[model samples]
Target: MSNAPITEIDIAAFTADPYPDLARMRAAAPITYVPQLGATLLTRRDDIHVQEKRTDVFSSEQPDGLMTLLMGENMMRKDGVAHLAERRILFPAVSPRTVQEHWKPVFETAANRVLDRLAPRGGCDLVTDYAMPVSAEALKAITGLVRMTPAEMDGASQAMIDGCANYAGNADVTRRCHAATALIDHHIDLMLSDPPPRSALAVQMQGGLAMTSIRANIKLVISGGQNEPRDAIAGTIWALLSHPEQLELIRQGMASYADAFAEYARWVSPIGMSPRRVARRDTVGGVTFEPGDRVFLMFGSAGRDEAHFQAADRFDIRRDTQAAISFGAGPHFCAGAAASRCLIAEIALPLAFRRLKNLRLAGDAPFSGWAFRGPTSVPVAWSL
Candidate 1:
């Protein structure tokens, strides 16, 4: 591999809480190779910000990479004109105008519907009862997989996410991921038989994208779209509950719900590390990279990079988060960003607080995963 400094990490520990180790790496070895992860990590914010846009060197077109091998080579795995072509095709469904004019109402309705059901429960795991359903329902509408239940949507998304990040090569994870993708294929076939008018699948079909590409791109949306928002919604709620002072700032109208969402994204960063393959030999951050080496742009760590943010580890809603790369910074920047912002900031966060009186935590809301991190279980209670 490259001549980067070597560091060892306990995968289990890293998954549970990676910031401490990431911080250590940023301080000492900004471009270090982790034997456990089999990749050189770029932990500092500036390095990642500068290098991510250099798709010429650190390419996303990893045909043999985990994401491609597991989820199929979607637009996220392509580069330059090839990537932009698919991105443009997929944009109509997630464009700012589309998200505001069409999907906003749908997302608002979905969030309210879930909250209506949970309003009487007094307490529930917000991750499942609220966040999961809301995210899945929006995804169902967006992806035109209305046939699948919220649970199915969430399950498939989580399985594929786990599979994509299964760098250690776990057979069971791979099997589940394959099963999930197969189910998605079945659903896509049904949708293709008679595509919905305005759904993402229908839009792509009309745009003349190949069937394989259509499937892969839809799966990519589901994998990221469902879980990231689910985690962000629940995690933001958990963050607010845990840090009432910050929540109070929003309550007093000193800060907006959008501020809370932005801060939480920077703090907890639901979608953490993005993997790239070295396309050619290059030096970045004073470290040399060879062609075909695996590199991880640690978005999670970048948000907390001390050089970028003051008191970076703390969850402060009022802090400026303009530098946060939670959505990504390259050609592969999340296409669903508008939809996610609408879902979380406009619909999910505000509605939950408005509808649920005396909202508070019921128990521990533990987060997990390094590659795709978010609160797994957010036990919460509210007045009936």
Candidate 2:
């Protein structure tokens, strides 16, 4: 909050290159309303943590906003007991044990299978060629969906994720998202007809959940599970490529990949912002807010908040991330965090570094999309 009036910036440019603007905002005004987007942006780490813990004050039950626009009115948009119950019902599928035991192998096999084809190429766009396929395959196995080519998964997942990304609800994005969502709907139907043994879909079917609720939750999983890891892995690689010393430290076993991944999540958080509704009139950080106001929890900015993190703008794998809210905090913490971590540490990053010996960037890689941020294209070359 600041004594000065709120300031507005172009959404498109800010999303494309948000770090500098985010730094300035955090310093000048931790909490401010963006007239251009009609949402209040919360950037400070402590402020966000306080707001997140108070679900009663800042609700997730946003109906006509981005959360519903992408995945329908699922648990993501529900607050209080309704959200708790839905999340509980959906919990077993992504539980740490379940993901580690069941989905880990799928991710490992997929990562190897992908690199098997791309490693020989000497150079490629890791975003499309590796990260997207590995993430999509893991989601397919977890959901018990029928086998799909990497390209198909990439296309479908990207369309739906893009729908989530273009949160302003552009007509083109909505249409594309709907078309991709149809594919996911079809898979849900197939799973309902004959649930896969021991899969998350099977758990839902056995639980006797309603078809509508099941579909909504399934789409939520598809949207989150499919997209988050893809962007995170790509972002991690891009971060490593940019910081070769840190990359070398990890490669030499001086630093663990898990630590590197955690730092990556903090430094270049893939899901830049999460939406919440101002549930009731509240005052925080000297700023007053009314009920029904829109709140964009700027997780990305929190990662770089100088008050919480030293050398916040620098990418340091050695930094402690006990306070990192990249997987979020409080009740709405991402259920898929463990799986995403396992994928990146055990499968994705290790393979990229080991198999693609002497891996180096092929060209400039820029990141975009404020809603779901990551390197747009990560081109790399390895020793032939």
Q: Each candidate's lDDT (Cα)? A: 0.92, 0.81
Those runs of model 2 whose alpha carbons end farther than 4 Å from true positions after fitting are 1-4, 165-167
Q: Tens digits of per-residue lDDT for model 1 on 1-384?
A: 889999899988999999999999999999999999999999998899889999999999999998899889999999999999999998988999999999999998888889888898999999999999999999999999889999999999999999999888999999999999999999998888887667899999999999899999999999999999999999999999999999999989899889999999999888899999999999876789999999999999999999989999899998999999999987788899999999999999999999999999999988898898998899888887
> What's the lDDT for residue 60 in model 1?
93
TM-score of 1: 0.99
Q: Highest TM-score: give the candidate number.
A: 1
For candidate 2, write residues 253-279 as lDDT tens digits: 888888888998898888888888877
lDDT of 1 at 172: 99
